[model samples]
Target: MQPINLAAKLALIHEHWMPKVVAEMNDYQFKLVKLRGEFVWHSHADTDETFIVVQGRLRIELRDGAIELGPGEMTVIPKGVEHKPCAPDEAQVMLIEPRGVLNTGDQGGARSAPNDVWI
Candidate 1:
């Protein structure tokens, strides 16, 4: 195994909502994504999703409330809970979830990204 540089990998990403896999453990993956604006409302039916803000700010809008996160902060959205992610400006984030878990979750359309793209 080799060490993965977060910033170095992030520099390779140029699009929002598209997550690039950097590493994997067991059946889970560590992904990096750049986010801005609002994402569609959706939920994973079987697994929880973790969001860690690497830079800038982000907001996870839930049906009942919203959670705001900044650099070095993170939140876990439980399975089956509908939520949308938003970033007023550009935000660099990391996601930890099981392999094959869709970035768009239950909601799929033009905004859905490829399931597992490695950098």
Candidate 2:
């Protein structure tokens, strides 16, 4: 396979909260998603989720507190922890998680994007 450019892939995305598959390693997938405003509170029961900020900022609000992530920052939210993601403005992010993990976790609804979509 050839190398993938993050900037070029990001430019092709136009929807917020929908992750587009970029690459894969073993059982994990690398996905890119845009964020703005608030996301639903949810948790993965089986595996942890990693969020890497590519541009702008992201805030993950937990039941007890919140974690603010800026560009170039990353965080891993352990499995089964309830949290909500929010962004003050448009933000680009990369997510690393097991293949088939849902974007909305157990709280599937209108916000849940289709899995395994590629750019």
Candidate 3:
């Protein structure tokens, strides 16, 4: 297998809301994405999701409250917790989740993206 340069891998994705898989180890996948505006309100009934900000800022809006994450910060949205992710401006993020997780969570819609794409 060719060595993967994470920086180069991340540079390949230019669209917002589309997460591209960079690497996978065990049952987890590492993803890189550029995000802006608001994402769907949803929840993962069986799995938790982790978000790590690589650049700019992000907000995870939950039913009870909201959490803001800046560069170098991270948060884990627990299983079954309803939440919506939003960013006023473009933000670069890395996500670590179970291999088959749908980015849209349980509330599937137009923004739901196919999983298992390897870069």
Count of backbone clashes for each model? 0, 0, 0
- What lDDT tens digits, residue by residue, belong to model 3 across residues 8-111? 87788878888888878899999998899999999999999999998889999999999999999999999999999999998899999999999998899999
1 versus 3: better TM-score goes to: 1
**Model 3 Cα shift for residue 93 (angstroms):** 0.6
TM-score of each: 0.98, 0.98, 0.93
Stretches off by above 4 angstroms in model 1 are none
Name model 2 segments beyond 4 Å from true. none
> Over the stretch 1-119, how does candidate 2's per-residue lDDT look in tens digits?
89998889999999999999999999999999999999999999999999999999999999999999999999999999999999989989999999999999999999999999999
Model 1 has an lDDT value of 0.95
lDDT of 1 at 17: 95
C-alpha lDDT (0 to 100) for residue 113 of candidate 3 = 82
C-alpha-based local distance difference test score of model 2: 0.96
